[model samples]
Target: MEKPVHHFSELFEQLGLASDPDSIERFIQRNAPLPETMPLAEAPCWNEGQAEFLKEAVDEDADWAEVVDHLDASMHKAQ
Candidate 1:
């Protein structure tokens, strides 16, 4: 079985996003944060596939659920 993704870095890698530390840091700094209450599937920041993946993790509470939830909260918090 594949290992679970516990950190944002691994989650990003799983989602085929920018997993590089510098890129992830810059992404966090550059983008507008999503609202805490917003559905990740409906977030403006995600592409359709990325949104679907996040939604699936949340809706099904899959192995990636914890990481997805953490991402949701982290992406919503202001610096």
Candidate 2:
């Protein structure tokens, strides 16, 4: 499925960041491309179950805070 494109305001709201163009640009520049290598020694592996869970999470129509919280909890549990 094609990912829906969002405005900067949407991204800022989702991230709980300031909805300013400069701030958004800085964030984009700082974290646009994630590194291919794992940053930690014991990074969580992405299996089929996790992938399905994430796909469901992303595709759900829910509040941004709830979605972020769910993702954070999942990552924390995986660690």
Candidate 3:
């Protein structure tokens, strides 16, 4: 069986944390280097749709305050 190579971005996504390059770089520098390979079950899965959504949201020129307000309302409803 082949081992898996993980990027810092994948690790943060799996841990439900921020996946920005700076954050990932800091995490990798602070922690021990990860193995070049791992079991498939332990590997992280990438989602293209999620990435696209994020890009679209970030690229929008509209006021983010309204977006934040909607998100907060949605979260409150979810709870």
Q: Against the true structure, whose TM-score is highest?
A: 1
Error of 1 at 48 (Å): 0.7
RMSD of each: 2.4, 11.0, 18.0
Error of 2 at 33 (Å): 0.8
lDDT of 2 by residue, 1-79 (tens): 7456555466456445666878755654544333344321123433455444444544674343344333334334322
Query: Per-residue lDDT tens digits of candidate 3, residues 1-79?
Result: 5435445455457446578988755644543232334322222332565433333443662233244233223323311
In candidate 2, which residue ranges exceed 4 Å CA deviation?
1-6, 35-57, 61-79
lDDT of 1 by residue, 35-68 (tens): 7677756777778888898999889988889888
Of candidate 1, the 10-residue stretch with the lowest lDDT total is 27-36
Cα error of candidate 1 at position 23, Å = 1.2
Task: Write down the RMSD of candidate 1 (Cα, Å).
Answer: 2.4
> All candidates' lDDT scores?
0.79, 0.45, 0.41
Consecutive 10-residue window with the lowest summed lDDT within model 2: 34-43
The superposed Cα distance between candidate 1 and the true structure at residue 59, in angstroms, equals 0.7
| Cα lDDT, model 2, residue 48 | 56
Query: How does residue 19 of candidate 2 score in lDDT?
Result: 64
**TM-score for each of the candidates:** 0.79, 0.37, 0.29
